[model samples]
Target: MLNWSAKRPVIAAVAAILALSACGSGDDSGATGKKDSDGVITVKLGVVGPKTGPASLYYKYMDQNFETFSDDFEEKYKVRFEIIGEDDQASPEETARAVSRLINEEAVHAILGPPLSGNALQVADVIQKSQIPWLLAGPNADEAINYDIQPNWAFQTNFTNQQIMEILGTRLFADNNKVGIVYSADGFGQSNLDHLKSWAKENGKKLTAEESLQPGSSDANAIIKRFKSAGVDSVFMGITQGADTATVTRAIEQAGYEPKTIMTTGTILTNYKTIAEPSQWENIQIVDPRNFLEGGDKEILDAVQEATGEAPAIPTNNISTYAMLDIYAQAVAEVGDANDREAVRKAMEDIETVHIGSLTIEKPFTTTDHKLYDDDPANWLTYGFDEKFNLKLLGTAEECLEKGC
Candidate 1:
């Protein structure tokens, strides 16, 4: 592995050699000058996310691994890639502007992320007009598909809110009939609440209590009190912020209520230990895409650590980013032209199954569906803490989907 931080001289030398190699005896007439007489094609790929905002850590992991991953991919597929990264600062308007720059200015063949749901929605029009293949690493809401705003060229690597809530509801409802819900007032929280409602109705169960708290609010005592009053046996949390989930957990404990509690994804696994008391976390179940500490591909984990000098707290986010690039590389190699965006889009649509390291994606991309792992329960995992406060994988979403509680 090339440690760019410690071995700058080696990286500089490699870059010099690659630059000389790219200057082949060919007429440089195009904007990107990507075509060479030797038939070696170079394509630019853009990545957009919150690299400097509150969620910068997630993008930092992806940025660190991109160079090494692209290098290896080029060596294996014989197609050169020039990766470009942009920071949206977690703003939707900035995301749209960044997309324009990537497509019209940088001439990137494909793009990854814009992490947040609202940011992805803001750029849907730009992506559709450019026909550039866009892979979203976050924004697990279904509004992208439900509103028909997501273009045919875009694909979501994360599980949608509907998929996650359905699985969680099914599992919780199996043993408890009096289920209460506490959600944020934002789009993501509301979306999960709506899905849970549908799942409850389908399972012939009624929501004992429901509470909606505004984003960034710290007062959760009322919500907890309401659930307690309703004699709820189980409490489902739809809060997106980690601190908020922690706040609610604290309230639940303060109220001296010990009902089975479940939390949604995006609750930073690393921060949970500090956010809530050990006893509070012990009774909490987390619905997540993958376990960060014990559930990722070893090889990919090593690569990320080597690049970032730290292990990712949420391995699935980084893994999904890596998977998206791998899929793009596969399409470029199969299409035989990195610059032909149309051919690459079609190639991705035709892909049935792909294995990147230890992670497997079966028919993840298709013509009608842009959501990867939407109905595939294997892609989602449930996690809980042991008696000793150590995290453990409970089961896959497939169990809940196949046999609802």
Candidate 2:
């Protein structure tokens, strides 16, 4: 059984997603793409992230991971991946512009994301008209659904922010009451607030307080005082990586408020610990997707870890980025032709199971849906490290993955 409910978090907006159902083959203006010659299957994937912004360091790490991706695909598929990565500076406007350049100018077969939907929200029209399959992974605010552009070839790997709230609701069922939320007051933070409120009401849970911080602001003493007054023993935060997570944690400590636990989104999990103080990370829990490369399961990842000198992946955004590369490669192998959209689309539609040695997902993509998980990874776990740097799984991590929930 599918087990979906009407109250489930939205994927696309009700209206726009409804319009997508009416997206018959209408009048279309498309890109006249150049063919890859010389018997090499030359393909391009448009990758946009904060390559030069606050998250630039981890984006550089993502670039390095792409290198391993391109190299591995070349060895396996006998193709060359011309990665046209654009630095959006983590700005939504700039990310939209970058996607335009990548698809219209660079002529990539697909477009990836800004690792945050607030930044990547405006480019769906271009991708849809181009008839290029967009394998997106990023922020999950349902902005993509309401972005007024639904590409027939679009699919998202990351879950919506509401789904993260669902994960936290399940966690609140055990050992805790009252979650204090610290959000960034932007679109991303606001949607998360919506999710948190809805979850609290549906589950008979109490919200201690909700704190909305301005984007890029560091002060949280006032908000911390509110949490203290409410006696919030646990925290639920939604913001991208940077001063947001660190400042929130610092303010909690400064205000003399100690939470029993904390739950954060993919935003913080992407680049949090690397930039935050090591002490701030103690006992903090963030949700994560499975990035199998970090484990000792495959030689490809081992080589990558050796070459990059980074820990491959502790299972987060890097893992999804790597998997997106595989989906593209496998699609091309299945049905990509030099000048045909139908073939490439069919290959992507036909993706069943992708078992790369040990890294795998259950049932994969089909014609009707594009998401990877039965429930999103945000539905799976609240994973983070303890004061001793040992990982702690607060929710359904081990149960869903190893024990087959």
Candidate 3:
């Protein structure tokens, strides 16, 4: 369970502060899709994410790319783009308010993200009622669209939990069926656990042990002990926070149990080299959308560095956000009118088999299925660190299944 004692007050304080700033000295006319007098179309885009809370680092990488995308889009299409960002502080309630302000106050042509699954769930109704084209760039939860929300207008850039677990299960079941899981006691973790359960059932594997912990929790010795007692051959981790990943890895080492460990993205942090012992870091795999060794999208990286004066050290989220924006831009260019949200939605749905950045999608969006990549192993890959502590691509999703890593 989440420790809400300290975070609740912080969320409330940030919400109050953002509400004042959002409502201060702005045109309340909710006008959208306006063309400038100079024949340059103005597209207002809304970005909602936690810029101040525990998950701030992930959103901060996303936030930095907005200006870069805005400038590039304007230069390419001769259209003026305006970005309206709202800090949700990782609160679901605040996400609702932020999305509301974007739709009813700023009147954005398209919305970017809420980042967290809980926040996305809170604003699903508002997004459906408003009929705004929303691109969920974070929180790989497949149920976000199935919660009585309209999937026609909602789209996701990240791989869903099912897709992630399928690849993981295929790879793990090939080598060892005895598995243990340690997940965060939150929505993201729950989604992962649910998907892993489904995958295990379908693949005829049984979990030997399962455990959960709150994010930022340092007490992982008990969970590690449980896994050790279970005598599992492989351990699957669903924790998303960097600190939690470090804590758990340390505990595993302290328990003197070294099993083939598989972790989800966001677990591999730069600080892990310092937090975890060198021996414990070996034989660990991270499943992620981007292969860091591939050096994603040099053009986008250059533009971001030029705009921000510093490029992100880890450019996975940066590239992913850019790809999402690129898709939106393609739809906008084809629709020719930034104000027609319905038309843009149609254009997005009509897109089939296009390569944006280093990733490729086939029939990326549809009315019923908002998920871009479902059961497509090529969309994800496994990565592990080499002896020099540099990221090395283990294999593609297909390779990992065909030949166990």
Candidate 4:
């Protein structure tokens, strides 16, 4: 086991060596990266995401990890990945174009990202038709993946909105709490609203108010006052950007009204803490599949920070990307041929478990289910932040509800 207390130095040293080894130039000649005579199978992977657009901040550590950890993964799995990145500009239209190009022009063996749920949906059909393994490390909307589709090519490494909402709804709607939602007026927020409404309806909970906030909005005082007027004791935020989340929090603080439960998605763990006041962060709770708290997965977090000299802005996505690569690499190794796309896809489906750094995921993917994390409370961690902006573990969703943290 890669325990933080025992093997910190060893992991750091290994990551450093790997970083040094991957300093060489890469071949971007659009080759298939077929198995060479040296017994090394090269996997050409198409990476689609917003590399230079507004949502580019979400993938800061993705390309960095790919560059820094190439040697480490290749050494173990005997698979060298030739990464081809496509900038989708965080747009559905751009995502369609990028996916098409990767399928036709690049001829990549596998595809990863187009991180937004809306973007993923835009190209889901075409990518599935291409028969390439689609590695979803970011988007969380349940609709982004369709397990009913035969030979399901999409594999989600991130927890879906349904999974997080189940945990959030249980806590937020408990004790006859009057809940209100403030979601961004975008696809991400729309998905959040859809899931929230579904959970509420199934559980017979009533929402006090539902407000939509546009991205880059500077003020949310009106929304805050509306919630207050509607007697909303709990607030569920589905905003996409951390800055927008901060704006809402700032408004709540300025209004001098504190909700009992201020629950939200992993956006709180993003740049929200940096921009929001410490007081505004009070009563906030977030449910995430990967525990980025101090006592959880510190080894990988430390290793990535050590190698890249920067902490991951979106730790969940960063960690998911790391695990996704490990799972994909293992699939390729099991098939023993990266060129055989169908075989690799099947291998990915049958992978029972994988341990990357300090995280061990059992049943990462199976034939019937393609999601890496489910709605199990045991697989999710609930956390609150301290005034100092450090993650304070409340516990698992079950434990947190039973005993206050």
**lDDT for model 3, on a 0 to 1 scale?**
0.68
- Kindly list the per-residue Cα lDDT of model 1 for residues 1-405, writing each as its tens digit: 222232333433343333223222122323242445655456665777777855565466565555345455555554555546677777788888888887777676787777666677677777877777777766676765433543377777677887777667766676655888888776667777888898888878878888998756777998888888888877888876666787888898899997754555654453455556777777676666654555334466666676546665456566666666667767887877766777888887777655456556688665677666665567666677776656677677676446531
Model 1 clash count equals 1
Off by over 4 Å in 4: 1-33, 294-296
For model 4, residues 143-180, the per-residue Cα lDDT tens digits are 87777788888888888888888888878887889999
Summed backbone clashes in each candidate are: 1, 1, 0, 0
Highest TM-score, which number? Answer: 4
By TM-score, rank the candidates, best first: 4, 3, 1, 2
> Scored by CA lDDT, what does every candidate get?
0.66, 0.60, 0.68, 0.77
Q: Which residues of candidate 3, in runs, are more than 4 Å off? A: 1-32, 147-151, 266-274, 295-314, 352-355, 358-362
Per-residue lDDT for 1-405 in model 3, tens only? 111122222323332333324333234332235545554555666778877867776666665565445445444454544556788988888888888888887767888888777678788777878888888877677877763654367778777788888778876655665788888887778888888888899878888888998877977999989888888778888876666777887888888887765555544552355556666667778776665554444555555666557655235556667667767776777777887888888888787654444446677666677666667677667777776666778788777767766
Residue 86, model 1, lDDT = 77
Question: Residue 43 lDDT in model 1?
Answer: 66
lDDT of candidate model 1 versus the reference: 0.66
State the weakest 10-residue window (summed lDDT) of model 2: 1-10
- lDDT agreement of model 4 with the native: 0.77
| Alpha carbon deviation, residue 362, candidate 3 (Å) | 4.8
Clashes (candidate 2):
1
RMSD of each: 5.3, 10.5, 7.6, 4.2
